[model samples]
Target: MPVTQSDIALAHHLADAAGAVIRGYFRQPAGLEIKEDRSPVTLADREAEAAMRRLIEAERSGDGIVGEEYGTKDGVTNRRWVLDPIDGTHSFTAGRAIFGTLIALVEDGWPVLGVIDQPVQRERWIGVAGRPTTFNGTPVRTRACPQLEGAVMATTSPHYFGEDAALRYLALTAATSGGHNRMTPIYGGDCYNYGLLASGQIDLVCESGLKLHDFAALVPVAEGAGGRMCDWNGDPLTTDSDGHVLAIGDPARVDDVLEALHRVHD
Candidate 1:
């Protein structure tokens, strides 16, 4: 189904609501705690998602919602919203400005629109299905990286990769670097890297253990900007993905990265 202009406007409105809550706690000391998964969660994340939820419930009462801080809210319609109020919570809690609010709309279980809003940086990227991606209302495109040797790669962190996956990721980056010694992949950008890739700043992003909310907003943004984002096996990302994700500015380079990732033992 096609996304209506009203839907796009509501997506931005959701981002604005999330951003307002996030910006209030941007640099101030936040009340933080560790979830059972050992990941950090702060008041900013909780309040921001709540803010978006309030607006969503008020405006689109029939739409479902899935958020990082709060659990699922079943809806009466097929349209659903995925929210990650603070994608880079570690950075956010550390007083870094790399964190952003992620908003994505899934229609019939498929993402049709996405927004990445960096409140501190005042940068926003909006992508809708069958439409050109926009950065602050201006159309944006990805830079070309016909090959891997010169491509800039980014990942949130290797710590999330576990031992076996980390080795494979290193091998893949080695291939991109032309050898094991030539490349140093950038680290710690979180969802910001995907927004950058959509805007053509980064070339490739490979990460493991992403949830629906983690990479959901990135799909439309990447594809809308002339890039491809998929699983490690080149499968389209969805709610059922295995959490291993690959986003490349150049579609031609995917096979090479996948091959390198498989060269190592699992």
Candidate 2:
């Protein structure tokens, strides 16, 4: 389906508003609170989510919302807005610039629109189903890395895999027998990594311990850029997936990686 101009407008507005809230707390020393899950939270997270939720309600009252900060509202709709108000609250609390905001519109469980806004970095990645993905406003495409050995892979955190997950990841990379592998620390880079993958700057990203809002906005962007995104088991990502995300520039390359990882782990 053709992406509507209104959808783009709303996405831009949401990004800007969320950016404002986050930027307001960007460098300021703020108190941090721990959620029941023990993840850190800040005023920026709460305020930005509240602002985004308010905007969605006022502008798209009939639509449903699934947000990380506030949880779900209403039921599934033809259009559902999925949000991660502040993707890197850890970085935000640390006064880092790698954090971002994620917003996606899912139509019948498929993402039709997506936006990854990095306020501190001043970059925005957008994707509309059936349209080319964009960084800032320019078109972007995934890299042409045909071989898994020639690919560059990234993950959110090795800790998600366990203390020894890094060793396991390194072994996996080595087995790819295709290209160089590097792991970079990124805050709020989960969705942003998919953006990078779409831009062809990065070839693959494997991450676990993610939530629906964490990976939802990235699916369309990756798919729109000619890449494939799924769980480690090669299943399509949904709200119920175990937060394991594997995004790669080529399906064959992704399959090769997944097969190798599973064989070793299984």
Question: Which candidate has the highest TM-score of all?
Answer: 1
C-alpha displacement of 153 in model 2, angstroms?
1.3
Q: For residues 60-85, what per-residue lDDT tens digits would candidate 1 score against the true structure?
A: 99999999889899999998899999
Candidate 2 worst ten-residue window by lDDT: 179-188
- Where is model 1 more than 4 Å wrong at Cα? 180-182
For candidate 2, write residues 1-266 as lDDT tens digits. Answer: 45599988998899999999888888896568999999888888888889999999998898899998888898534778999988878777877676789999988777788898999888998888888888899988897876676566776667667544455565666755443334333324556678788988888887777888888888878888898888877888776788767888877687677776765566
- lDDT of each model, Cα atoms only? 0.89, 0.80
Residue 219 displacement in candidate 1 (angstroms):
0.4
Q: Estimate each model's TM-score.
A: 0.97, 0.89
Root mean square deviation (Cα) for candidate 1: 1.2
- RMSD, each candidate, Å? 1.2, 2.7
- Candidate 1 lDDT at 223 equals 90
| TM-score, model 1 to reference | 0.97
